[model samples]
Target: MPSFSHDPLSPKDAADVVIVGVAARGLAAAARRAGLRALVLDLFGDDDTRELALAAIPLRRIGAFAIDPADLYEQLAIHAGPDIPVVLGTGFEHQPEVVERLAARFRLVGNGPPTLAWTKEPLMLARLLHNLGIPHPQVFADHAPAGMRTLEKRIGGSGGWHVKPASESRGWGWYLQEELQGRTVSALFLGNGHKARLLAFSEQWCEPSEDAPYRYGGAAGPIRLDPSIEASIASALDAVVNAAGIVGLASADLMLTGDGWSLIEINPRPGASLDVFDHEPLPPLLRLHFEACRGELPDLALLTPEAAGMVRGAGVFYAPFSFEMRLDPLPDWVADRPPQGTRIETGEPICTLFAAGRDVREVRDTLARRRDQLWRDLSMASRKAAE
Candidate 1:
């Protein structure tokens, strides 16, 4: 078992940093690349994450979908001390106060609470982008905007699981958005609270669940782009980062249409796509993130194209039905694996699949093949378990 408690302030016994998030594997992996030991407050306690972490506490034990801030505070008390750096990942957007509390106790190396507050608020973001003459989908806060292709989205939602048809149902903190037609594209960048640097652009896709159609499936990148489109995106990111005073790792989601890219939202903390872009020979992003937070920008070398004709992709595989995990030995290509014999509900993510190829189509085909192979392997394992 990974250590849950380390001797406070003892470098020999303590982890170098504390990582808290629903998707902590990428952060943990990045930390290890920087030669740092990570104590990860993770939701899944995935098998691969445990291998990379000094400690991987299953935040799922506290709650499946959302985290309780009090539980996180208590867990930190057990595993970390004030000197340790804390980097938050996805899942803290709606709880800025909790981030504020963490900042008061530890050295936070990413954007602080105030950044999340401004960036995640739908109306505020729409207005900011509008003021900057950026294209943004119309946001309706109080009542639904009649006669527009609309979506009902949960406030501060990251993955699209919280989005649904505007006509189906509505609840508190839910706002209506005009659904624009386009390909989903994202810019993974680092900011120094004033100037910004573009890391890479990736294409994002949705893997529809039984309930959620826009649920995030995967992303692939180092995608080369037309110079004009790239310049427009770079300019937009610089403006938003400066206006929001965003620092450290951040991402801007956009809709690339027949006309141009429209701003969707800016994720202020470390994003899920770190796994897509972080690789060998490139300086580990976590190291760059720290430097950026300290007001230093990464070298332009990072913006250079990846090696000719090579691209990488990451995809999530959700369970087809509720079942007990029967694969005893997990595959190398898969990540974020739950323990064998654990029960997983229908539509819940079972693992992540990684693949590489010359272009997007090949990468997608490889991931699909891997997913099929995994399901077949599970069937054989389950039958053997019964025998």
Candidate 2:
């Protein structure tokens, strides 16, 4: 459990919303910008998350990834009260039935469990994209045909941590997907029950670990694509929204394969790309998400790229030690901050690094330097710890 620096400053009745997920800082921060007091229940009560949230409770998982729903539903009123709307995020993909339970108890604010159940099934998504005439890699349940180039992905997973070379998989709940050679780009969109609108796009990259080879590093963009391709992706996304009955904020991950772009996955809730697309001249995304769920999408003009838009990027910097190291001070460019003096384990994420500039390289370079600095600072701290 994450320790709060202090007790919640207000009673549960004061919260305007409650968010639940593996990580909820970004959602809580968005709520704060929308002038709403958000109570957060997640896997981390990081310094900034606790600060942004009116109250933050660290939720326990039943096993590896699924949040213990009984714990979450039980924690709800005691932390944020009965009537507060609940916004779901990253951790729910593998456990949509828990989503069903939450909806029965609270005013569920985004895609419901039925939609999730339909969309998150790996084979179902592959077939749906194929049925829609949208290009998608072939999905294999038992095995990929002999000599087929493929990769194994967790059945209902996020953060790309579950992806690995097909030869490395032990199967079970995993499925094999034909390998597609290309970079990944995501379209963050608003779905108003019937249709969806693309808010922005971002190119994704990974920071591989020995075990989690395709672990998601971060995303950076509103990157440009050919007009024809953009139209096609938008069309495909709309078809998916209508077909899946998707609602509120979601992102479709598409990869540019040799044949063309292939739709890979649909995150039925707000995702990491929010660190890129959520900003002004745009209304608060958390607010837009609420309105969209209520059956209204933001006017497209408000999202025009020329209005205060610029290339920006965010990257995740993981702890670089086998031993624990206390984070001395939070850097200015960091979000998802663990408290000062908190020890982060080797291979765990320390904080999210942000940078914005005239172009991708500028932001990329700046973020690289930030990571280098953390690498050095944390190294020195590790040495001191050993001493």
Candidate 3:
């Protein structure tokens, strides 16, 4: 049996749960709600994550983009103790080898490294989908087929920034896929190796910049899906889970187009849409995630139905220019907050903004208004600080 510890201040001690991710806030919050003490290791140990977690350790950043995996392993070893159950989040899809190593060292609570490697490999996933009769974007593993509109994507990249035009000729670890025009949607689900239960469907939004046109911006859901469309998606999810042995929380990205839905990619861990879909009276998603991983899925009928009626949205507010943090009283809706006095570089995410309503459009509008308000407030404070 694995040992569990609740102490946060003692790094050498064990923890009940250890969550590693790029942004640990959502998972940490879910853990807290489940009455579990979690030690968080991530790139951004945001204020909320720190508060929710028993302890939060930031991974050593490699330049502006990635984290040092060696540092991550060192910190996990120091804080995780023996046989502690660890749950991985974002920032790991690209590091399957590291994930495999970590699994050998700790009791990883979600999908195994082998599953991650297979699902995250574009060519492999494309083949698997093809065999299952699951529709996915046409992939060109070597080069773009001449005269067809295609996007270049990097293996192990998340948040969509790693995607670009195939014509640009970016170096290795890249593949081309025929681009499709449609509404980007994500389905969040829980799997138990052989089957999956749907949780919510969300519309994915992107914020385009000259450097990253595909950069992820936000998500809104539980967007109503046509009955036929919903069934198709659910069937596809079940096929993938059965084929790949997917366990725990996972999300699939798809393009809803005139022809039909086409799979874009799969996030084989807890995803960004977590905050928007999770609600009260239902089990915390982390708890469900752990249960699913152990092959003990809850009665799908017991899961709350409120998520279907309520709408929620979350958006990342990027820093417009290099500036020192000066917004003193952070608003209630802001999350993933950097500490005051931290210098933020242009294009870096400042914080996440959230809003909820009875419908998707309402929540989306509220999120936009909140985002603009936060930007104005932060900008005003920066100007005053310079004076």
Which one wins on lDDT? 3
Tens digits of per-residue lDDT for model 3 on 64-156?
767689998898877887577888888877778888888788888888777887698888999999999999988877667678889989888
Kindly list the per-residue Cα lDDT of model 2 for residues 1-387, writing each as its tens digit. 333456555536667888888888889888887888888898867888988877788888776556887788778856755477889888878877788877887888999977897689988887788888988888888677888888888877888888887744566778888888998888889888788888887888889999998998888876777778888888888899988889999998999876479888889888887788778766788998999899898777323345546777899988777545465675778898876556677788888999987777788888889999878876777678677
List the global CA lDDT of all models.
0.82, 0.81, 0.83
The TM-score, computed over Cα atoms with residue i paired to residue i, of candidate 3 is 0.94
Q: List the residue pairs that clash in candidate 1.
A: none
Ranked candidates (lDDT, high to low): 3, 1, 2
TM-score (all chains, Cα) for each model: 0.94, 0.93, 0.94
User: How much lDDT does candidate 3 score?
Assistant: 0.83
| CA RMSD (A), model 3 | 3.3
Give the root-mean-square deviation of each candidate in angstroms: 2.4, 2.9, 3.3
**TM-score (C-alpha) between model 2 and the true structure:** 0.93
**Residue 166 in candidate 1 has what lDDT?**
73
